[model samples]
Target: MNFYKDLEPIRRPIKDVLAEQKLFTNFPDNWHVVVADIVNSTQAVKTGKHDDVNLIAAGSLIAAINAAKPFNTEIAYFFGGDGGTVIVPDEIVNKILSGLNAHKINSLKNFSLELRVGSITIGEIIKAGHELKVAKVEIGKGYNKSVVIGNGLKYAENIIKDNYLQDKESIEHQLLTIDSSELNLEGLECRWDRIKPLTSSLEVVCLLIEAVNFKNQSTVYRDVMIKLDEIYGEADKRHPITMNRLQLLTTFLKFKKEMMVRYSKWKIGHFLKAFFETLIGRLYFKYNWKVNDLKGQEYLEQVIAFSDTLTIDGRINTIVSGTKENRLRLLEYLNQQEQKGLLIFGHFVSTESIMTCYIENRNDKHIHFLDGSNGGYTEAAKELKPKLQML
Candidate 1:
């Protein structure tokens, strides 16, 4: 009369039970999990630097996995020379993908290494692990390259769920479109009129908004205001040939001044304002703070052109000749853009003479940058992805 007697018999063999016990013990239930491995391990070993390569490979894997953990996924097990296993809760699958993508980008940027990620739901692993052996096969397949195994998941799902998901191609396309649209607006405006089209000035305004949003210190705001005033004073000294153009520049400066004053009263304004000031300060130091120099003036022009092509929250790594004159020019260009409303963050590392800059609209999410001799722009960006969501 027992209900158990009416149920169908279990089909899994004894060995399967034992294996499942070994792998699935302590594994969380109702979660989606991913396991990743570095490809070409043997090749890295054959190069006679096996120990170093292994350490790096292991470090990269750990970093990538940890990066994903914040989204509610946990590393269940690590099988060195094989791969790692992750368990993700059903409710947080979208979060897990975002963390994974950010980790992938960071790993690529930091180590110049690529990853192949494979993910499977816990339910599938529990059900199919006994019959189809999907978990074992997929985990084994990911050894040298990155691949994901979940059937129902789509790229769009990842994008919608993860705010930090940065698609380089997509970002580039958007930037181009923003610039084109802005340029078209300029064409419709009277060329003889003094005021420039608003489109060209959006970045500057965005920066002001961001500065107001992220800055936290009153002193920082005060300092930024001083710097802004100095920039305006210099512009006044130049005295453009056309009164309309001069008026336009003055009006823009006045707008920023008012925005800065309002920004200082907000809770986060100090931090954002400070960051902007620091960015401008760094650029100034790189250029020796020579605002009136002609070369400095030209550098500012190039920065504007470059700014038009940048994605909000994008980073750029470039090496320019490191000279007092060159740095001064860079500062001038950056300050001009700042006045125009572009939020720019940049620094120059002396050891490598690398000028790394992160530029974005003020309201756009914050993207981090790493400044140093080696190339780690991707890694910095990857790490920043999660932080960007906090915005």
Candidate 2:
């Protein structure tokens, strides 16, 4: 019953975790990988709606999370800038898909963006000779993130995407046709304003890295983490979010945007209630009120503590803040690795960071997602994909 939940958290340095294959176990055959992405995200980002793109991607995880809650399994997921990937067992796949379809419909009606959702079983990927090595890594302050090594995710992405391309019209029809109104995004909050670095000298960089040879992935990624630890210091030294920079967005416009996600058809009464909640929230955070035994200051610490600043899903994707000098050194090291044909990387720079949060349980269970305000990982990918072509 504890398929996903009971895995012991690995507290070793992430570098060591990646190198120890025995630490990552194979996923069960009955499980499936669920993937979702906004179609035409490149053009969408150009229009300055990267925030919307980010939310839709987060939606997939939230919807699936809500669906899986009853089954009592902690599904592991990755939130890419434009979309996300989640893995769930077969017992709840239908309910999960239904919820995702509902979210897709909401996305089209509100943002005019097409969200494609699909799933492929682990059995099939294993049949095709790919591996799905997974583990839960404890980052700090009792929070954990799911890390994956091996080509399993890459193989699933390729197949799901190819299928979408071949059956484009079917996807469109399902979006309009699937009528599932049971999407409970209860604690999905995006109220924070864009977070600026603690100082003007620091800039946010969204970076992506992958090994060239499949077999070298373990060693290559291990080296990247070791290098990052050297350049960035511990995670706290270069964190983008700090207590002083945490401010709730109390604008009516912000409420209206969130309303579209919680309600399919808007209700003014509900909107007013939410607007008042934001007003009250502003004071709660400002005053550091101990409402319901949860401290605002302490919660801010956990927000930084639980933030998805670094993620490894057969590749390394991270957003961090640092001086230009530190960034240059990182690039220099990465370039040297690339020249050796050990790895390839892509990165984009921006002025500040933005956050979208999922806080189902205020005290114990929650995590925050961050992106560079401009484009984050998607913008970084523009550089990364071109490099892939020459290979």
Candidate 3:
């Protein structure tokens, strides 16, 4: 089913679907689920390489999409802070894996991060006795993000990690000898500087929560969102991204490096072109240039609109900007929820958050990604694992 069209009918929060069990449908058995996350991401984040970690994670999505060549085929993807998950037909799994291998290699050579990439089949997930149910969440007009609402993907992630731990040969053997010279990463950009909260005393919190029961997970998540509103106001009000906060870097080194990430290498002419483009970007941010019916202000709003700030992919995860007091209030609420057997939660707070953009256009096709500057989601995910495993 087409996610864009099908998700239009789903107007309620996913909690309704989880309660009814009718909104999610089984994925085709021939399809494969691909997951990639940076190994030792915690260390990298601690070492002050969080942006590289995020780029690698976003790059994984680019790798799979480029390799699959799914011009008209339907694909589903979810971006975690450290990496992401992509679902594609088995017919293109090998190609996608090879592209992932290229990404893994590039990440190591360029940024010194080891991206662990692997895939598993729907049959294997079913045989493991965990359900895999898929649905789409509509975020904007004709825009949506696919969500998986069962333990099957979580199981696959664990198995893949186990394989990475035990079978180095098989993992290495899966790396193909294909040429990735023409890597496709058309929509990704990181022009904006880090975003500090509106108030100096505020903090950026990244968190993940999983309920003890799948049946109650959505309800618990809805409560958490409600609590956020009560404390921090609407999602837009809590968002850290804004036009005044946007800044374009003019450093030649950063310009060259960013260009190289998209292109294998560049000539003098390419460098000059990129330099001019960077200037134009600065001008646009400064002058509020309209791109496809959206000024800088409207564009920043769309950036927040399409972000994965709060998401539910087998578990609820969020990267929010708020005051320290509000953050503590939410934590206390979470502890109370944990006490009541509603959910178990983990969170880490940082002084500032970073944004990365993937603008297919300034219109609804654009999406922004955010993570706390120093050890954001990686640290939160680490704290979450022990609790998630116990469930």
Q: lDDT tens string, model 3, 55-98?
A: 77877787676665554455777778899888777777777777
- Residue runs of model 2 more than 4 Å from their true location after superposition: none
Per-residue alpha-carbon lDDT of model 2 for 138-233, expressed as tens digits? 888568789988888888988999999999898787666677567677677788889999999999999999888766688899889888889987
- State the lDDT of candidate 1 residue by residue for 137-246, as single tens digits: 11111111111222222221232324223454563343333211111100010001122212221111111111222222122233443443354322222111212221
Worst-scoring 10-residue span by lDDT in model 1: 182-191
- Tell me each candidate's TM-score: 0.26, 0.96, 0.90
Once fitted onto the true fold, the runs of candidate 3 whose alpha carbons sit more than 4 angstroms away are 1-9, 12-20, 68-70, 173-176, 264-270, 291-293, 389-391
Global lDDT scores for all candidate models: 0.31, 0.85, 0.74
* Weakest lDDT window of 10 consecutive positions for candidate 2: 174-183
Residue 287 lDDT, candidate 3, scale 0-100: 80
Question: Residue 100 deviation, candidate 2, in Å?
Answer: 0.9
Leading candidate by TM-score: 2
TM-score of 2: 0.96
